[model samples]
Target: MPNLKHLLLLSCLGLSPACIDVPPLEDPPKEDPADPDADFTFTATPAQEQVLPGGTLDCDVRLAWADTTGGAVTWSLVSPPAGIELQPFTLPKGETRATLSIRLGAGTEPGAYTLTLQGKSGTVTKQATVSVTVGKAGDLVVNWVVPTPGKAYTRGPLLLQFTVEGGAAEQVEILKDTTVLVKPTGSPYSFTWDTTSEAEGTYQLSIRATRGGAVFTSAPRTVIVDRTAPTVASFLPAKDAVTVGVRDSIQVTFSEPMNPLSVTEAAVGLKTGAGDAIAKSVALSADGQTLTVTPLSDLTAPSTVQVDLTAAAGALTDLAGNGVASAPAWSFSVPTWLPMGGAVSAVGGATSTESVVLKLDHDDRPILAWAESDGSSKNIYVSRWNGESWFMLGAPLSGFSAIGTNAATPTLAIDTAGEPVVAWGETTGNGDERTVFVRRWTGTTWESLPSPTPPSSLDTLFNPSLTITSDNTINLFTSLYDTAGYSIICYQHSNQAASWQQPWELHDDPYLFNPGAPVSTTSGGNIFVAATVFDDHTSKRNIAVYKGKEPYLGGTTLGNSSTTPSIGADSNGRPWVAWSEFDSAPQSDGQIFWARWEGSSWTAPVAVNTRATGNSTPSLALAKGGPHVLTWSGIIDSERSILVSQWSANSWQTMNAPLNALSAAGTPATAPSVALNSTAQPFVAWTEADASAASIYVVRINR
Candidate 1:
């Protein structure tokens, strides 16, 4: 085209066409892009938040900067609800995150709200939007931690626990009905409600939680406060019952329901009269109101058993958590009577006559006194069983030898020192005069007591009965007969007195014969006498009982056509009498009847012998804390046999076999006497007469 310069100029001048054909000088090499501004981005971890009135919510705000360095960022909330506040805070320079706390104040309305969070640094600003919800009363809930609803509480401490959800509790209170009972402050809210001072009734319980100035209450829970203690409603084997079975179980009923778990073997127990513990098992009824105690083994016969309920802490508790304040106890007894060893003959001879008197010493040894003739004369003799054989106590008490002058009607008793005391009637040579003699054994010899005054010459003393009192006094009762009539006399001799006391006529009715051998006993410092008197007007003999002295307490008639009256006393100082009564027409034999004097009157007479045979000469004795024992002679299968029976369990229980005359079927056994030992055993003494002579025999019954 043209010269270089010219061509260049022309090409340059021709720019329109040349510039289009030539590259546009490569657009002057474009420069690299520059970095962004040094600012941060504001964002929230969660886009939603929930908070209850008087509660707080926390949100995490993060800053993402484009550069390694940044200034402090101020935090703020936009368009927040009334009473809502954002905790003033700022993210320091070089920090990447900050916490935003949103708090709702008291009395704040509940609703859904949107909160805009703003963060600004120098001339830069960033914003984040978050959804917020203010919780209402329905959002706050209270749950019971223990003592579930509808449970009853007794007079004790009760635990109350509760938890608050959807809110923070600053203070918690327990409300009983509309009243505030207590204010508890702690985590896992709980309190001990002492109900010991509360009245018994139904009440409503609730939990009240307070945060800031707002309060929330839970629904009412129904509960019962029963502060009444349980009582013993009834028990088995009624107190002091004497007829309880050996295998009977004890039952105790409560006035209200009891806690089943509290009824254990350690809480109830049984014991023997000896204070020995008895093994037993305890059980509770289905309704949780009764408790039963069963012995592991059968109780011993003739033993007293006691039942005990413990009153110790944690021993027994009712459903309301009340404990027994007092221990309950009771006692009962079992009865048994069985014969011991075979009967032994005390004395046998060709001339042993009259009734034999028997007594037991402190050692339970048998002592005897009777009248026997040696063909030349009759005298009163004393003997005792050494647990082996009979040994004479001393020489015959009387020295009479004339044919008509003889010893008879010997009555025997034992003193407090376990010494023998004897009383008898001795007739003079002419038989029209008789004297009453009493003597006591002083270790080795018989010491004669003062002799009672003699009646008129024609009057004769026949039968004599004697007893020794607890105070060492001698009491003697006798029968006197004269031309005018017969009368019974009572005489007493005290160890301190100079001589026998003035005799008192017990009964003096002309139509009444001398009461035969008026039996006497001492109880509660008073003397009681019983006898058989012949009533000429009724043409029948009747039994009479008298108590005390001079101004007698009783002259009560017991039975008609009755004989052989025996008297005794009980632990309560009450008098008990037994006798033989003749049956009605067609029955020639007699029956034994017994009666006890109550505080005011006498109980109805009860028959002792079950059979209709001739039962006569009955003797009665009462054992301490035991039953009454009786012995008599009866005709069985045309043979005379001695019978023994005991009044127990409201009935008479007769021994299985006859006591005497078992080997000699035709021998006649008569005039029986009974006594009880210290161990409550019964001993019987009787007379057996064969074709040759009469003899005395003794037997015992074990418990």
Candidate 2:
């Protein structure tokens, strides 16, 4: 081509004559050829490089050891991956380095890729290698350190952390047992778990990582959840507490959250000192840690109560499913224990005390009737309990201007309508002639029957025992001194306003004489009576028992042989018979013994009192349907105290304290009668000896 400036200038001169002359075009200088003796070498910034699909990697390849000869070099590339794009790059005529830009295809396959650069000088060609590792579709790697096997985690986070290598990750996930705990995290490969709602147990943890267009999974690992067993942190009405109100609820606090259904009435027991379980209900607090036990009925006052926790019944458990380590039991005292009445006698005391009879009124409070012998005459009196003290029901009902020598032993019982009924024997005509009179409470006041329970006859009347059957029938059992010799009599007063029926003979052996007082109770419409009858011909006296459809004792004897018998029944109408038997040892008078009817037959009569010297007048009673209690006069070492015992462990056990410990030579503990309220707590009353000036004393059995 010709120089273009001269032509353009000549054309401009002709067109305008004022055109400036431009310098004549000149050819550039040519450099010398590259030295053929120089050596050639090549290198890359990174020996090996990596790139993810749809990603780029910038790298430098240096051609060092160049000849600098200015010899023109020819450049070309060799062997490049199909998914890799080598951007156009050229090295200067004599340069040391060149840049390589590698781009990966969006859908590239995973494999090793090689990129080569060739520098040619004359007949020689020098090459450098650049490796570009393109990641596959699912190229993201995932790994996790698992929790220790059988490991336990407290109340905190249970985390699942994973490490990703190779390619970049777009999402991650963690899965627990049957649940996906960690959802897809856009960029993070770790997940944290909350341990609160989870129960104590073993579970599996798994991980999944997603990168590009593929997903990867990790082997499952184990995770644990645990919490300690709940503990009894504190309790209300603390151990051995006193003066607690009857209505107060026992509250128990726990150290940790608990399962509410585990706390039950059977799991937590409450019992009176008499070893009778109290009526109660269970309540759980909103926090699931506190439990309150409320008494369904008022607690018997001035009594010790036991609280028990059952370990086997699964009483309480923690969220971890752990139960109490042991069965726990404790006790507290109710100082306000209710007393039926105190000192049922004159202000200064009386000359003598008659047998005291106890009965529970409709409301379950006690009503007592007893006789006081002021040296000359025996007076019969009635009284009602106001929970604390006692007051006379009415003026002396008997033992005053009567038709008998003196109104003697009086007995008490409640009628069908929950009315108090009292019966006593009074002397009439001659000193030997006696009659038994009857009176019933009209709810408002005491009402006297038109006729005596047992009409007077030529025979002397002994003390009588009375019981009201479920059908509201009043039954009378007594020992009658008839012309046919000593005989046991049975009288029934059909309805409330009915007259007495002709007495049915229970035992009428001509050889029987000097009969002791008789006691009786009814069970399941059947009657049980116990009495001591002495053989006139022989000095031997034997106790007799009768079980009949009616109120009379004519059944098999309780013991092999016995004397001075008494009887009682549980709320279930199960009868318990107690009596005195002469001991086998020499100089031993009698030992108190007892037996119970377990529906089919009587239990082997078991001896109650240990002191064989002088045990007499066995009396029996039971907590409505709970433990049984029996009392008797025990004269040991010449002390003459009322040694009381309770029925437990299938035997009689002594009270924590003796019922009567009066050791005074003139003082005595005699004629004890045992009774129980609706709650099954027992109350025992007896005459404190000092016959010259005696009083009726009462004590409550607080287990």
Candidate 3:
């Protein structure tokens, strides 16, 4: 440092003179080109361009400006034209670079436009030319494909598809011809057309595909909306009453064509004889007309069944809209009982010219008949009454081989159930013993009663009589003889419990003579057995009727003397007896006699018919609450014939006129058996020779 005073003066003089000479300190010496120290050179890339007419383009403007102060840069739009919008612009940090994007309005005119970009350093402008036109809407193309051509599908759902190309579709109309199926709004148009609602027919489908304010319809494609025709196949259980559960369906057969909806509206109904509709559930077949219904409950047999349909109801309708003219109702009957009818026969030959006689129950109709043939077994014959005519049951068991040799005449009686039963004897053994066989009819089945014993001794069971009581009990009576004599009367009883009582000897006598067939009748629980018993010499037969404890019931002989007394009892327990008496010797002709039993004894024999010839083999059948009909075979001239008479209005009416030829012929109709059915009409089973085969036959009396 210089000395304090003098050095200070020198330092001030130097500093002051220099400072004055600097000329106000001209800013640091300028470089060669005037202001070289200041920032100047910079450039922006791809800044200006022109766009084509109606064409779209994008422009990115980059900015570069030098800063004299050396700082960062940013850009912004300074001038924007009308209908123009500024896009995003960015700038770099600590540098002078910036970018901007500009868009022109759609309606801008074709002219030059300037883009002004302002940065931190300064603002710049870029010019562009644009040729503007107009915007265009998108186009649409539609197409369709038909899957099935002319084929008819079942009545149900159908599917279809549509295709659209070019621009995105806004709406799609799928039409079956002029009929619109689906009108939908969507992009990439496609649709399914359901033809379930359409009838069976060929159709054309057109798809109208629309897009972006433009619409186009595709060419119509031929499509068939076919449906199967309805049909009823067949009925069930076609023959008779069909038993089905409540849920079962009743099917009706249809030929063709049906509407399912219409069939649903029709009602299937069931009914009884009273015309009441049976409550049931009903349904229509898939194709319709065939209605299926179930009854609410089960039905009983022996009833009339009816299925009804109403005209107002749509039972079945075709595509033509033609319905059933009238609802058809079907009816059938349920069977109550099985059928039962067959032949009636006796198992023996007519050894004697005789009338076949049978008795019927109170509830049955009566049939009187007879049998006739030569004494030899071969010619045994039969004839009968047919409701409207006379016919035969069948040929008799006549020849020795047919009957196992030597068969006796037939005897008949009405069984417990009002059916006829027959019994007879067959001689097979060499010693003259006979087998007695029996059989009866019970409407549905034929029942055979077991013989009491096998044919045994020479003096065998003969002249067997059968009588069925009201309680379903059957009693049989026959003469039992030993080598000594024809003594005791043997009795057999059906106990009414499906079994028979043991045989017992009824009367004991050394010479009991011939005992006629027993006839029994009921008054409440009391049974009366009546018969004709011959005297010791077998000359005079006595009419006898018994009451109480039968077989052992105490009874007295009624009429003094009458041969072949045929006896019966009416519904009120009053007895009537008829017989024939020989006029002269034992070999002579006979006459008819009648008597009535009044509780204690018979009224006495009265002449019934008087003729020059013989009147014999008198048979009597008393109806429970009706008439007593009588039959007999008489000999007129040299001929043997048969006649019938009925007791009516306290007098006998001769039924012989219609049968006069037979009654007055050489060979009379004989072996007459009578039976009645529920209607109280007589049915006769007899043997006659006038017919072919000389067979056994049946005939129903007109009265």
lDDT by candidate, in order shown:
0.72, 0.65, 0.50
Q: Write the per-residue lDDT of candidate 2 for residues 1-703, one digit (tens) a residue.
A: 0123223323333221111111121122233454554455665643224456776655556554443444444555576666666655656666655555567788877766676767666666788766656666547645453231223234445444454556666767677766677675633344456677987676787777676667776545655455555668888899988647677788888885555546666778888887898989887776667778899987775578888876423446544445766645789877533234456674344466667877777687777788876555567888777777887776677633743347777888888787788888877656476777878878667677644444454566668788888898788777776666566677888774457777676745555555566778877687877777664544566665666533223334455447678887777777778887774665257677787777766677777748535787777887655777788887766666677777888788876545553446757677788777677777778888664677777766443
Flag the better candidate by lDDT, 1 or 2.
1
TM-score of each candidate? 0.50, 0.50, 0.42
Order the candidates by TM-score, highest first: 1, 2, 3
lDDT of 2: 0.65
Considering summed lDDT, which 10 consecutive residues are worst modelled in model 2? Answer: 16-25
lDDT of model 1, residue 107: 72
The TM-score that candidate 1 achieves is: 0.50
Total clashes in model 2, counting residue pairs 3 or more apart in sequence or in different chains: 17
The lowest-lDDT stretch of 10 consecutive residues in candidate 1 is 17-26
- Please name the candidate that would achieve the greatest lDDT relative to the true structure: 1
Model 1: pairs clashing at backbone N, Cα or C within 3 Å? none
Candidate 1 lDDT, tens digit per residue, 201-280?
87788888877777777656666676666778888988998657667789888887677656677887689999999999
Question: Candidate 2 at 77: error in angstroms?
Answer: 96
